[model samples]
Target chain A: MHADPIGVLTGAHFIDGDHACSEGAIAAGCRFVAGYPITPSTEVVERIAERFPFVGGVFIQMEDEIASSIAIQGAVWGGKKAMTVTSGPGFSLMMEHIGLAAMTETPCVFVDVQRAGPSTGLPTMPAQGDMMQARWGSHGDYQIIAIVPNSPQECFDLTVHAFNLSERYRVPVMMMMDECVGHMIERVVIPSADKIEVHNRKVYDGPKESYRAFETGRDLIPSMVKAGDGYRIHVTGLTHDEKGYPDMSVSAQGKLVQRLMDKIRIHADDIVMYKEEDVEGADVVVVSFGITSRTAIPAIEQARAKGLKVGHLRLVVVWPFPEKRIRELAGKVKSIVVPELNMGQIVYEVERCAAGKCNVVSVPHAGGTVHQPKDILAAIEKSLRGT
Target chain B: MPRNEIKIGGFGGQGVILSGYILGRAASIYDSKYATMIQAFGPEARGSACSAQLIISDEPISYPYIVAPNVMVLMSQEAYSKFTPELAPGGILLTEEDLVVTHNLRADVRHFSIPATRIAEELGKRLVLNIVMLGFATALTNLVGRDAARNAVKVSVPKGTEELNFAAFEKGYEYGLQLLKKEPEKILA
Candidate 1:
């Protein structure tokens, strides 16, 4: 569906990533934002607060991150597209609710503008340390989609895509940004509302008496009904049957959990997104995402200038790990180099996907700032030398 | 220009970041070029020396941060002392004449000074000093065109203040043009 013209601010704006993400959310038909003020990510909610009034949207400054996270889920059930913005410390607080959203198949977006730390570390700096946490932070076997944006333009474009994916799969999607990209300013051209596609959750219009909240067809994704729809629907964190009632049986748990996992796993091929350059016959390929992808370019160029055939694989969607593509490249390339702001989160995933077919090199950073190109270059040279 | 890295620095509320943003908008939006701006954060940026780093080029920018700036716009003495040594050799240095004093300046670089704050006060707002510095930089350096910079200033400033900002820009630009005519050898030096 095309975006609503009232919510879309179509123009050539010189804005930062946080503001761009807010514009993208508005363009994507999101009308509810619940968040607590946090560094870097605060601008996303700040912009939402300023713009929501004009567009008939709601912005609530929740008591804390825990309340903020769950409030968005509540808004979702009230027939509104919703999101919550936070950083590392707040992201940690929202983990249990993220699990709840997955359990109940809530469609929402979580914006984590990552900062340095295990605990409030370097509040104003950049880091990709929450990557593993985004995937595994919420304890569960269920899967979620996470997208990484490298620039303010992507911050706008991919945010719209994030909402679409979340609504399509009925799962929480993570807009994984870092402090650097969140604060960096660039020209972001937001297209007209007619050109943008927005996805809304499917609703159950069947007879209210026959409505089974968790019932689905082959796709394993059930249609949703809001709270005031006068349909009897039970939503719970416990294992639920087709009637959405709590089921304690092991078999019920297996069936419901398996469907939740397969809905994403079976469609992984269609959901995964990435960008590749010169990987056909390259000896070494550099794997990176988010802000690190931009930072790794100069290092890749330096490697190419020294007569080395280096390729680049930048992950637009970081989760689901792009296992198939990494496995395919491992056979052809001699080494894969992974660089990120965190010490080593996504690199291990690369190593697992490589599966010893080729050597995997990880250039790790402690998270206060981005990686130096020379350091990444040295790693590329070392990877090529098999040292 | 193939590529130019510029850094603007001052105290917290001196509009250092806004100056960089205007220049970037001028290059990227108005002039159809590419520009990227990154501002410093944390405790240092609260009240002490803060800075905004920018890069403008004909090609798409791969790396975001500036390695070494070819142009340095210093609006305060603290910013001047902290950022001057990092300026690339043979680069251009623009400073606020009344707020900063230069000593042992680099010989390889050309220096230009403007009383931007005083000029802005004369225009009834001390906040527009950054706009004045922008106009001075536009006239002295070939980084961006005059029309593009003027257009950016027109749209970027708050409503009803565009006239004041434009006047401040014109005063600085006219002052820069006069300086260029008076010291042709110095500019070329």
Candidate 2:
């Protein structure tokens, strides 16, 4: 489906990632936004509030992050594409509602422009510390889709992808942006409405009397009906049956929870996205994401210049971890170096997927600024020496 | 040039970030090259010393942060003191004549000063000091085209204030050109 013309700012312009993300959400047909302003992520909502009026979108500055999280889910049930924006501390506050959204299968977007944090550690600095949290923050067995954007252009492009994945899978999609990517200014080319693709949720079109809220086809994703529709729908955090009623039986829990997990697992191949460069024959490979991946480029080039066999693997879709590709690359390369803003988050996933076939090194940084290209280059050199 | 790293530094109230933004926009958007601007984002960014780092390249920018800026523009004493040592050897240093007092000279460095704040005040708005600085910086260094910088200023400033900002920019640019004409062989590489 094409984007609505009103929301599409079709031009080449200089803008920051936060503003680009707001434009992305609008072009994806997101008409409802509930958010509380926070550092690094505030510009996304501020732009939304300023532009929403012109496009017939609703922007609500909620009381807190918790309200903002749940408010988007409520808007989803009311037949509106919705999203919320926050940073690390605010993301922590919204965890419970994120879990609620997962159990209820409400499609929504959560944009976390990550800052340094255990708790408000550095409100202004960039960090990839929230990578694992985005996947495992909510309790129980559930899966989510998360995309990390490196540039303002990606911030505009990937946000539309986040909404599309949210709608297609009936799950919350996280746009995990770091502070640098959120604040850095660059040229962003937004295409016209006809060129942009948008996805709407699959809604039930059957008779209201015969509607079963959670009934699924082979795809595992159930068609949804708006709250005001004639169909009777009940959604709760408790494990529910296909009819959408709370069921206490173990069998009901197994079926519902397993379907939630399997929906993503079964479709994992199609959902995983990444960019690979020169991995065809390499002694060392650098696996990085977000702003760190962009930072790794110079290091990779320097390693190659020094007569070391080096390649780069950039994760655009950070969640669902891209285990299959990592495993395949592990066998081909001598070692894989993972550099992240956090001490070490996704490196563990790489280690597990590599399964000791190749050496996996962690280039950990405690979150303030990005890693020095020299440091990453040093790691690549060390890995090549070990090989 | 293959790639050039530029740093703009000043106190918070000064348009340090906006200056960097305009330079980057001029190079990337108007000049049809690649430019990336990373603003200083720490506690000190608000009222204390704030800065913006920009990289303009013939190819797409890979690393976003500036290691050693080949060009440093200072608008305050604190920004000068804090950022001068970080400039690359044999680099160009541009300063606001009224605000910053130069010290601890480097022999290989080329330095230029302009009264950008006074020019902006003469143009009737102190906020356009950054625009004046941008003009001076653009004229002194061939990092961006003069026409590109002027176009960037036109789009960057608020709607009705474009003419004033453009005039402020021209004042600084003319001053810089006059300096170049007076000293023929010194810093015009």
Candidate 3:
């Protein structure tokens, strides 16, 4: 499962987050990219367009975001690992197709370089406002995985991981980035192709006549077959049976929908990823993700300087929200402080998981700029005072 | 160094961002330190106010944006007027002599001026003025080593233009060294 040598760029580069993410996608065996230019995220596709030609990849700039989003799914069905890059406005337009990708179990990646929003608000500024939307934007009860990267290095590393997760679970993966992380420049060292692991979707190997597209083994994830692979298969967005035929029966609806949800839920422990520091016997733990994670570090350090025992929990994977870990930490610590670029999105999830066992403090900001360390330090001190 | 915050400001086409990028590349790549650069983005396309903020530290940087810059490189009158007030007390200020006329300057801050545009013109390309400024900053500020800065300029600029840029850089660096020798008290620690 090692990466292809032609796609990997093995060197140390001083690149921005968007460009690093593009390199990561290329290293992960992605051969198809469809996107519409948008602020903060356009650099990802721009780099792809420049690099794809040499690696036998395709980069298509569609007319609109709606077309760009669904076009990646079509590319996936043609046996190419694919993805699309976008920002807030385009992310909103792609919600329906995200739902469609989930319903059809199309393995793809959606890179949302978020900006301040609620209808074209501060297009060049940073925000984590799309966090809730990425989880619940698509209607229905299916599950998708979302990952947050804090630095240009992680933008290169985690993007490859995002693709692997999508192919393994047969669900769409969201690469949730913000304007700050998207534009910040730093040194990113891409390893050699032999050191990187890439995962491809399992292909159906059974007899063609007995092939059922939706039939599953013990893992609840079915094997896939491409369109031109000399196999007769049908894929639909409606409630379908194991034969991939549209079924209106109540049993079929429950069976199909339940499997989709259970596939991710059952493997939530394996999909969840995070980083923690000094949480063992600490009074307050600061929970943060994306750009806010780096911004919160100075606050954590200042709190520690003042003779306060403060811990930090940075979310590398924002979705499938580390429920078990939060529940465990809530029982041990006196309080938890959550800070984000958006005004109180992930804090509610913290509150829900804490379940009143300890006080939860939310440090909210309406996005354009990142939070000052003093504000987060104040919130951390306040959370401890309430207890 | 614990940490050094730098701000470079000029018009959009003056290569303000690229200067910051070269400095950052020298520190992080050649000197083996941590550096982060963030640029200001807005509706202004070209020939308007633009800035790039950078931080270089021995330890990992937590916050990405610069608070109060310890060093400021201003290439235009507008940039000089806008960014000088935010300079840290006793900070280093480098400006283009012909472009920015400093008046009512702060007594506590150490200031240095060079005709970077004039030097580039003498070398036959005004586009390499930013490279000249980078050389002067390397000599006067002592934030980055001269050899590291030279290597960065070699790799960062477009192919086939290294000779002219290097000549421009050495001219500015020699000018800075002569200025320091004339006034030894202005030498930075």
What is each candidate's DockQ, to 2 decimals? 0.86, 0.83, 0.86
For candidate 3 chain B, the 10 contiguous residues with the lowest summed lDDT are B180-189
- Provide the lDDT at A384 for model 3: 84
* Candidate 1 local lDDT, residue B73: 94
For model 2, the superposed segments whose C-alpha errors exceed 4 Å read B43-47
State every prediction's TM-score relative to the real structure. 0.98, 0.97, 0.99
User: Which digits, one per residue and each the tens of the lDDT, describe model 3 over residues A1-387?
Assistant: 999999999998899999999999999999999999999899999999999999999999999999999999999999999999999999999999999999999999999999999889999999999999999998988899999999999999999999999999999999999999999999999999999999999999789999999899889998999989988888888888998999999999899899999999999999999999999989999999999999999999999999999999999998889999999999999999999998899999999999999999999999999999999999999998848
Which number leads on TM-score?
A: 3
DockQ of 1: 0.86
Query: Model 2: DockQ against the native?
Result: 0.83
**RMSD of model 1, in Å?**
1.4
- Residue-by-residue lDDT tens digits, candidate 1, A122-173: 9999999999999989987889999999999999999999999999999999
iRMSD for every model: 0.8, 0.9, 0.6
What does the lDDT read for residue A198 in candidate 1?
Answer: 91
Fnat of each candidate: 0.85, 0.90, 0.74
Q: Which residue pairs in candidate 2 collide?
A: none
Total residue pair clashes for candidate 2: 0
